[model samples]
Target: MPNALIIGASRGLGHEFVRQLAGQGWKVFATARNDAALEELRGVGAHACKLDVARPESLAGLGWQLDGESFDLAIYVAGVFGPREGAKSAPTRQDFDLVMHTNVLGAMQALLLVAPMVEAAKGKLVFISSDMASIADASSSYGWIYRSSKAALNMAVRSAASDYPGATFAVLSPGWVRTDMGGENAPLEASESVAGMLDVIAGLKPEESGAYRNYAGKTMPW
Candidate 1:
């Protein structure tokens, strides 16, 4: 069985990934920020750990704890939707900081810490990015903070791919799935989005590194 590590498996897309991957016989190590959530993840048969991706100390501890383990897949799935008010409205400093620190810095930090393990296994490193991050496809003037964070995330992952040639690194847009972040009005369900992503992951190639792709494995603009 392939060993997989999923960061931020407390809920939503992260939790769904744990559920599906475990069902498919992958040996999954999942992380959440709290014990209750970790327990919930454990319920789905994933080995759960506590992690606050934005914190350097937490990442350091995690790196130490998993010292010799190698993972076939490692995904950074933690993010925040900050200040729903669009580009027109100015967000408080706290909300803006929260979004950037959690999405961009947090993901980058996690990837840097785990890259060695992923590379050792010649595995895939996936960052859960967003279509909103697409500078080449921007049509809306909303969620600038969230948009900017994910945009930075995409760039960071793309840059990391060049540095970590042994690992297949890519960003994925999970579509408007009906999760807590996507809201009730969103069209697609979490299952559908995760299933598509699993299919894409199953067929990942080293040559596909640095690409921004959708859940269906189609390339998206960076």
Candidate 2:
């Protein structure tokens, strides 16, 4: 069985990823900010790690903890929300700080930290990016923070892909899934989104690196 690491595994797509991967016989290393929320995965073939990905010290701790373990797949779902109603004009520094830090920097931090393990095993790194990042599909301008941060993530994934020739690095837009983050009106369910993505990942060949795509394995324009 392959070992998989999923960050931000407490809820939303992250939680579902852990569940589905576990059911498929993977030994999962699950990370969530709340150690308690991760408790739900107990006895579910997951080992929990608490991490606030944006914090250097916390991520350093995670690195230390994983010193000897190697994983075949690493998925990142840790991110933050954009401007919500009244929090605009006078947006607290914390809000702005969190939006960029979590969505952009935290993801890079997590990927960088685990790159060695993924590289050693010739594993895959799947980023839960958004379709909002595609400038090619930008017919409407919306969701500033989330969109821009995901755009940045696509670039970073491209760069990382170039740097690691032997590993699989993919940026996938999970589609409009019905999660707390995706809202009630989103078209896809959590299970649908993750299952489709897993199928895509399963079929990825080394020849197809540095591509920006969606959950269903369709090529997406960057």
RMSD in order of candidates: 0.9, 2.1
What are the runs in model 1 whose C-alpha is more than 4 Å off? none
Off by over 4 Å in 2: 84-93
- lDDT, residue 39, model 2: 85
- lDDT against the true structure, per candidate, is 0.91, 0.84
Q: Could you tell me which residue pairs clash in candidate 1?
A: none
Tens digits of per-residue lDDT for model 1, 1-222: 999999989999999999999999999999999999989998999999888987889988888778799999998899999877787898899998899999999888888888889999999999999889999999986888899999999999998898999899989999999988999999999999999998998788999898899998889987
Error of 2 at 112 (Å): 1.4
| TM-score, cand. 1 | 0.97
Worst 10-residue stretch by lDDT in candidate 1? 82-91
Please provide, for model 2 over 1-222, each residue's C-alpha lDDT reduced to its tens digit, 9 standing for 90 to 100: 899999888889998999999999998999877757768866566898878888889999999878888778889888877775331445566766788899888888887888788888888888889888897887654566667778898998888887877678888889999999889999999999999999998888777876778998899999
Task: Give the range of the ten consecutive residues with the poorest summed lDDT in model 2.
Answer: 84-93
Q: After superposition, how far is residue 128 of candidate 2 from its true place, in Å?
A: 0.6
Top-scoring candidate (lDDT): 1
